[model samples]
Target: MNGSVFSSCLEASLQGQAILNDNGEFLFVNRAFCEHVGYTKEELLLLSIESFVIYEANEDLMKKEPIIKRGMQQKQVEKLILHGNGYLQTTLFTVTDVSDLNQGYYHVQLDKIVTTFDDVDFSMLESKLRDRDEVRLPKKILDGIKDTIITIRLDGQFLYANEAAEKLFNRSMEELLSNDFWTYLKQNNDEELLSKFYQLLAGEEYTQFEVYKKDQDEWFDVRAYRSDDQVTLYFINISNRKKMEKELKESEMNYRSLVEKSPETISVHNGKEIIYINPAGKKLFGIRSFSEGALNLSEIVVAQDQARMRENYRMLLTGKKEMTNSVYTLKRLDGKKFDAEATTTLITFKGKPAFRTILKDLSERKKVDDLIRKSDKLSVVAQLAAGVAHEIRNPLTTVKGFLQLFQKEQEVKPFYLSLVMEELERVEAIIYEYLTLAKPNVESVFSKIDIQVLLEQILTLTKAQSNMNNVTLEFEYEQVPAIYGLEKQLKQVFINLLRNAIEALTDKGTIHVRILKHPDNQVCIQVEDNGCGIPSERIDRLGEPFYSTKEKGTGLGLMVCYKIIEHHNGVLNIYSEAGKGTTLEVILPASN
Candidate 1:
């Protein structure tokens, strides 16, 4: 062929074309080829292919010499050629066998790197994938591509869609084909993008831009190219990457702001040396200046914690751990010891591994906690004193009066002596009960006791309070079997239950206390009330000490009751509804 005529015709061709001699010197270049190389035809013809073709830096010349030779499939490589404008363009080279004439024509492809697929058997792959009845090479090619590929007509109507495109749009081909492609996008103000999209059907101008899916909250990097009757769009789902970049930039700003203004002492250390300390950290540690080597980590950490801090420092450097929190007695610059809560995290500062520490002073908090504990102990002691005096005073008076009667009478009858002994025993029992309440370590001598007598005594004690509140109390019980338990502790438990029952009634209400012999040789007692009931949620936390719903009430009352019942191996089950009343059931093992 004539060189000028062939070059002119190749200039108008869509594919980039070049002719080279056996020496790899360019003889003829087309306009498309020159544009692909970013050079003029005259300038391109003066250069040799080996000089213009880019090999890796410090690459061996002998290894790259066989690329342009006649029959080397090794020539099928991603040739990143240097453009005239100092840019490296990814181009692929395929040569014909005209090297016999000392010249060959090479087809140069730009815009994509396809050398990776040169070894793949596309014919076998297509045979398995294609239907026997349909000739659909374009569909197979479009489907084979990893990127989301979609084709649209000049009017933006869908022509063909691939699996990736269906996934990105979250729709099937039938759903996507029913709508215009532009319906999934909003109008953007970029004139350059608008112009490229308008010229997409002409196969002349190729463009790439980013747009978001109107239906999905995702950003897609789109590259549009025109083929025979349709415009093909290659979509890369860059939503996560784009979102991460945006979030990283925002996090940088937010982290800088938080670190600068945080109240906690924040400092950075690289192994043994202090790199950066915020204003709060510097003030807390009494650091006056930032000399690069003046702040040593060992000087600030107390001697006991220095070894631990060193171990954690090594872990951060090796990336075995990222963050740690601990309490330490740290030293200030003046050598004063103060308790500090330190949180250290691994971070990269100045592109090097470093540890960031945030410290909070525990001095004031520790002092407040100590004071609150002391106050709580004093309050418990005062409540104990009041309860002892109020509970035992009447019994002491009854015993004193009976002793005076016996002293006034010269000769006392045996019945009179028995009366005095009974009153004296009641006073002694009250003393023993208070002592057991104080120290639960007292020895328990379990005996068979009348469960009915225990209930009657507790009701009689709370009778005055019940009458004062206009609360009626009723009971139902058979002469049940004797219960094996400590009499004083059981009495105290009943007293507490009855007192709480009386208080539950706001106005006039009835409390039904029942004692029954269960079928399994267990004695069961039910204290049912028609008064203000406990809420369902707080039922679990009812026996917790110091957790009370009443004003000026210590939750110790119910807790003590539960402790006594548990000592007897009893189950105290409480059932309550908010508007309705409460039912407290005590089930205990009966004696033989």
Candidate 2:
């Protein structure tokens, strides 16, 4: 390398470097060395080495140490020094005593700072131990161990044995020495142990396992390690520990069975943090897998009950209270809330105190409560509609007839006339819906109706309505034989369903109508829409009279559809998810 390049490399080196004379005074210094002490190159030479040294082993900075010059490699030492900002820095000092480093000056190098002791080559230390023959374990140390310790070879020749090994083999040391260790075996003479011994000698690694004792009816955990040229085997009796582990496993199985079989949801929590939840506990929280469940109890707790739940948790965790049962509303992962009665009891778990909670879901009871309230609302609306429906219809008809007459006249502004006609028709439809609810009168027009032909007609009727709302109507049909039903009634059922689907759409979407027939003479009609879906809780109320998701909906249209389908001996089912879509399936029996 060029001389200038070598000097530049030395200046840019991360290791701090400095050239010192025999007196350890700085003769020259690199940029890193200058930076190490927060001083420039010119100022560094003016300062003595003793100025940076926080602690020195030799005390005399100028004294020549034998280890520094005699060792060919760099000698590392625990060196602490003061930094540029007056703070102490721990560093690994690598000193090279070069006789002619630069004009006969010595080089002092400071490597990176590490919070560890000085680095020493461990291989060289190990080489010295390996240089000698076997270093025997003393008899005093050998007799003190409770484990059976033996020094053996690949050929099973015993070199040494401890007192425990002697008692185990039932032989004196004089008789056991130089004998094949396997010859004294009463139980374990399998090739598995022999293969392992050969592998050990082949320098695989140290291994430990459990084996049965032949001379004694017991199990021992065996440890095999190579020390120098010999392999040492240590066997410790573990029969009692093994028996205890088996009993513990049996007890755990029983505990697991009880937790799984219990009908009530059971969970254990340490304070507000949930530690364990059983299978039934997951279902009680309206979850199939608890992996996505909240790790803390507060997540599933309703906002209104969170503070009370926390208070109850705190009370149960401490000795202040032993038991508490409170009715709370629990929210599921899908944001559905259900009523639950939670019972908490303080108990010892895993050697520490914890709270055990049992939850009984009250969703069925909530539905019954809602039914009672909805029935009262329906009764009030029905009586009022029946009292006024007859008195208003005669005058509403006269007003609609006059609007229709003006809507056709050339002198009248057609736009205003059409607006009046639209409002009058809306009023007429609501009156008709209320009258139908008061007394449903469907004309019994039974015929062998082809569902495919009926759906095609229904689609044509709703296509314009769907297009006006920017929604597409998609129809797929698989033809089949006709069935006996009220054709006009079925047509009415589909019109209401398809129109409701189109109105549910918020943006450009599709309404799919599929008609298929089964081999068992049954026809299936399906209406699927890519619109706002009903929530899980409100799905059951979809076809109920006087209930609707739409703003101005009377809910009577769906109830009439249900009634029309019921008269045809057909079944209706709705499956939906919030914001996804809704699928309605109608399966009716086919006829010859």
Candidate 1: list runs displaced more than 4 Å. Answer: 1-438
User: Candidate 1 residues 195-301, lDDT tens each?
Assistant: 66875655565778887765577788889877555577888888999989999999998998898788888888786888877788888888887776579877887
Candidate 2, residue 578: CA error in Å? 57
What ranges in model 2 sit over 4 Å off?
1-138, 182-188, 271-273, 292-296, 347-353, 363-592
lDDT of 2 at 303: 55
Model 1 accuracy (lDDT, Cα): 0.71
Q: Each model's TM-score, in the order given?
A: 0.29, 0.38
How many pairs of residues in model 1 come into backbone collision?
A: 0
Ten consecutive residues with minimal summed lDDT in candidate 2?
129-138
Q: Write the per-residue lDDT of candidate 2 for residues 1-592, one digit (tens) a residue.
A: 8967866877878878877766556876788887766667876676656545443333564553332343335777655554544335576767776785445456678777765323546344223222322212224345677888987655666666777887877778767774676665524565556666666878866988888765577888888987546677988999899888889999989989999888878888876677888888776666665552256677788655664565566556555457877788888767788889989998888898878888888887778878887978888777666645643565466666666777666366667667667657777777776666655546666778878878888888888888889998888988677888877667878898888888888779998899886434667789999899999899878877657898867677888877667666566768789999999877676765
Positional deviation of residue 401's Cα in model 2 after best superposition, in angstroms? 78
